[model samples]
Target: MRKTLPLIIFITLTGTMYALGQSAKAIIPLGGNAWVTGKATITDDGLTNWENPQDAISIYFRVDKAAELTFALRVRVPEGKSKISVTIGKHTFSKQVANTGFDTLSIGKVMLQPGYIKVDLKGISRSGNVYADVTDLIVEGVQSANELTYVRTGSSFHFGRRGPSVHLRYNIPQEIKKDVKWFYNEITVPQKMDVIGSYFMADGFSGGYFGMQVNSDTERRVLFSVWSPFNTDDPKSIPDSLRIKLLTKGDKVHGGEFGDEGSGGQSYLLYPWQAGKTYAFLLEAAPDKLYNSTTYTAWFKETGTDKWLLIASFSRPQTFGYLTDLYSFVENFEPDNGDKIRMAYYTNQWLGDSAGKWHAVTGAKYTGDETARKNYRKDYSGGLKDGRLYLRNGGFFDDLTPLNQKLEYRTSLPPPMIDFNQLPR
Candidate 1:
């Protein structure tokens, strides 16, 4: 059986103007059934079911023009089953209730042609019993023209049971001489699993430049490895420095032993993360360096090996001063790098210093053995012996020969396979 609450609406000024220079108009009202014995408080915090037997609720509003839309709703289901739905005209978006506590739902850019909008809530019950509560609903109007657009790569990268499609967005700052690359990813999971995703960026001179790793599931441990040129401010210098960081979900995961400091060392930093949590990686690069800032999240589930999936990459480029960010989603990822598991990070580049001196840092290798992956630590570092070196000329701004030295490599000792049922969904 399903029960629903009365319709409620609320509106606030958003300071949005149309092309005609008129303030955009929207209609909203304080939500909930006013006739109820106790007032149903509705705020941005989300919706809650105060009365157990109450039916579902629906809210309606209107937009005068075509625009993008964003909204939030809170729902609480103490027992049984319930769901919230967002309806724009005839199209309805809905999600099933999982947790008994309050859960927040957010919908990204949706095109709203001038029409009526309605959000409906339905109480789900098994054996003719309904158990659920709902409260606050907030809606915001966004301009369609202002939304950032992206190009879909059609190709997808598969990790574990999860598969995430690739999208790329490029931005070139006016002043910087370097390119800032932005790699956008959309990950879809059929089920769920414990998962970790990361990207390695490097030049030849320094061993590896910068590494960013994100763990989507907090309950299980994840192993990460990377090899690159050193880290330096000069674009003309070959990579010679290498640094690696190990991360874990529970306590601090140990990273392998790093080489001596300055030569190419390793460091460990404990990041506050929870099990069954999803996180995003925002990596930025200016003319001379790259770094990470802020993190967004999603929930983690354990399902068959085919359940957990990830879509991520390190291809975005940024101008000298501007920052570029990349995002990844992990759902139902489990750690079971069965035999044939292959993981690797590789890169190559040439740099010319301010002295007009050009040196090529080529043939760099930072490989991790089987033991490294098996006993994965939160903090560790080491060097590879297979790396190379090269030399180039000055006054030459373009040289494909030296720049082409950059390459990436990966070999799975056991090979990667989709082990869906092996995970906890």
Candidate 2:
């Protein structure tokens, strides 16, 4: 037999790829009570390990589903390098630090999937000495789904008649696929009701209107409003007066007055809508001639009370010769608090044909609160109820009857809550 030379087999792996070393796929625990073993190399030469080699850090964790991640960090830089790099998965995010003593560093948004996730922190200094410290770290949107929801109260007269319009818009992340739904309660104002003109039926009005929109594409905008006529001279035609109301749950407790009359004008309440969820709405209106000329519109929301608070109002004259005569007076406007508020309006336009020479007036009001101010993005953003264009037995309204007018409304589901327990240690 010929002697075959024994062949020697040798395999070599380097860095984090060695068989005897930790596998790149291995899960590592970090943060709050997690165990890790690697001696940090420290040096004062302002070169070797940079600043204090002891500052380099690493974290590991697993996710149950793919998600959008955000990290909020407060950092302090002493005097070396102005750049810091964060390594996660196969991507690296770098941030530039101002030479200032303290600053906020955001890692922005990152898409992450289920499995082991490792984050490596590396800082580089100018003279070779990098010094920095991370005080807080917050990761959001992992192991959770997005949802949205809304609630409305009140009703609108002339069921099919399109009234005023309210619009809403939001920015959505690309990672989520969501389902949406809308809910509402249409109420009718009772005869001889004690409530103000255009107020809710339960509060005693002749007609009412309410509706909401939900889960709208963050890229697309959503609108809600009551539709009515702009001219009333032809009693055989729809009238042109529109009114709305505003209230808040916190008003009474805060010693704020509630009504449709004042120099502060009308008020409006606001709410923050989550990216994915369902919402419900209620719209109400009444057109009785005896009290119909008094147009009333307001916005209200819960502020830790059972009853809605009046935060904004939209009221104007119903029998004006010109649409330009309509104007809105807003008051008590704030824009910081987050919550969807309610709005109400009244009009005699429903008299349809009985009223003549319709003059449309459109106005907006804000409750003087931090939240309402933040929402509309203006000291006030409404004007006298004005007709964009007059329609005299025209296209969409030619054969339209108060009972046959088209009415549209919308709302959505609630957003998903994040699971803090599943976060990387």
Candidate 3:
């Protein structure tokens, strides 16, 4: 009886262990966390229109601890049959799926360490007209699911893939905070960090923003934009009297109106700006009390060049103010390149008071947008480095700066020497 009792206790313990392992489960919606690098696309309904075998879907999620995770996909084969494979690190699992309706099929398991994991799915072969429509990726055996990070369901998939946007808010000296007329800053993208869809904004005020962007593999641009006083996403809905007017622009700069984010006056100069080279941005805000409006001007130039090219000067209606709320930021604008890391170094930040005296910007605070604040994504980082403030986002790096951390520069640099009289009219 004693020997039989010991065996019964052992059996009970083993059964309990198996039950615990089966209970750890998490469902990651592909609509928010997946990216299709090929012709296929992931929409609100999840992955769809996967007609090509070359289409590769990369889904990202982070686990907090090392565990053997079993994966399953809630998917459907709209036509015949397809053989697909999911690759995680060195381990690969294949399955032949023929479910015509939505169902969760187990894709097998792999051992992974704590960090961001990429699940790469591709069609090995398809007997149907198309591949498969996958809606979700499921994982089991994670001890703690709350600590994991990924794009949660019901969030924005387009922005989820774009990752987080990070910023460095400059601390203006108390006396000149409200009367600052000009903001001067510099940016340099280090080698291999000039990623496509990256916008390295140098001057950001309360009313408008100015920056440089990697539009594509063959195109780069210096862009400036001013939000309209009328609050609407469609520019046409804005009354003509409330619209922003272009006062003037430099040669080869395109000045127009833009929408979708916010209705605003947009201008950009297509310059082949290279990485690892310092560039300078200068912005001016002049208020006209007579007309109750403010005029904003921007200029960009290579640090070593003597010439400063004008981006565009815009007159904003229904506003009267100098530059307020100065800051700098870095963001990934393209959902396709959000998985890649990008960074920008901002230095020599200085602002001019109404009296034309420049004050050194010595302090700043790191902040992120709603995506970072809600913790939907955790790949953003910002801090002081080499006496300069750097902003980094995307690539799913493990180090994320705490939101709203105040920072001060350790090195003092000379204020930029500029002859106001020589600036282009």
Candidate 4:
């Protein structure tokens, strides 16, 4: 039976940070869920899940840090004379699998870094053109070989089973109230992943969020919208006067990608995007003419480009007037086959006030979906890697967990708080 879970409690914000150390030794798997290059595909034949590639292929994954590693691969050589060669850095090992069933091959230990590492496999010889088949890669023992860093690539907390995704956020130090003008960040869509959800938002009685997304290989867009304090899903339940609008010319508005749980609006299909490219996004919110109303606006510019295109705007009455949260996340939209690895790099985050002053946001806390926190199902992975935030999810991982950690906790300040009690009945 599926279990119901409560929303995660927000961690207190402060200036203190837990000193993270080197990655401890654990068995890390490189399999269908892992990122690969140079010709590989995942296949399941009713029983086993395996990755097969044409001869001379390489697979990549990150480790917490440098360590002496004992590598293992489950192999199936179709013929008696078939042979395979596996190489890691300067080391190489050869083996012959004369049986039809899968067998294990242990490639002895070697030193490796805590970040990304590539393992190469070559089909040396096989009879009648039969290719050698194998499962995933695994490391047996580990010994830290480098100094502790902020993030580790191959950490277990970063990947998992199939389901909803995870999130990472940096709360702004100053409360972006009715007078604040903007929240900004420069981010890159990570190469080789399928989707990323990013946004700058404020938490209040009525919450508002805006950002860009890479939903699929072909679909990329910038989205902006606001959640009404009302709880009804029916758009008609809310007057047209309260709906969000696209103030900019040449932009399209569409139904929000989020499901029906509240009164929310979205403007999307506004622009096209590419992978591995950086784009700057700015979201502005301030009090409107009404005493308790606020106007929300969004702007975007691709890196190396000068124009900051206006995306959309919406005005909410009887609401908090400032931006409260600056956060981003990675998720899989297509549930059936949607669970594939995807990531995005976020940096240069800044918060802007009505006075035209900007403050830098250099650190943040890591969190995940409530379902993932309650269920042991391993379906997502992500966190701060090499000083930038990254998120990964989908595939066949059954032991992956979410990376949930917060840096400095600031008192006298509160993140945008969602008022569930005030939600429309």
Relative to the true structure, how large is the alpha-carbon lDDT of every model? 0.29, 0.28, 0.87, 0.53
Model 3 alpha-carbon drift over 4 Å, by segment: 1-24, 51-53, 143-145
Best by TM-score: 3
lDDT of 2 by residue, 264-344 (tens): 122223333222222222212222356444333322222122333232222333422111111111111111101112232
Candidates in descending TM-score order = 3, 4, 2, 1
lDDT of 4 at 86: 80
Q: Please give the TM-score that candidate 4 achieves against the real structure.
A: 0.54
For candidate 3, report its TM-score. Answer: 0.90
Superior by TM-score: candidate 1 or candidate 2: 2
Worst 10 residues of 3 by lDDT: 7-16
Separately for all candidates shown, the number of backbone clashes (residues 3 or more apart, or on different chains) is 91, 130, 0, 21
**Higher-lDDT candidate among 2 and 3?**
3
List runs of model 4 lying over 4 Å from the truth.
Answer: 1-162, 174-179, 195-206, 215-217, 240-242, 245-259, 289-291, 397-402, 408-425
* lDDT, candidate 3, 154-216, per-residue tens: 578788888899998888889897899999999999999999999999999999899999999
Residue 342, candidate 4: C-alpha displacement in angstroms: 0.9
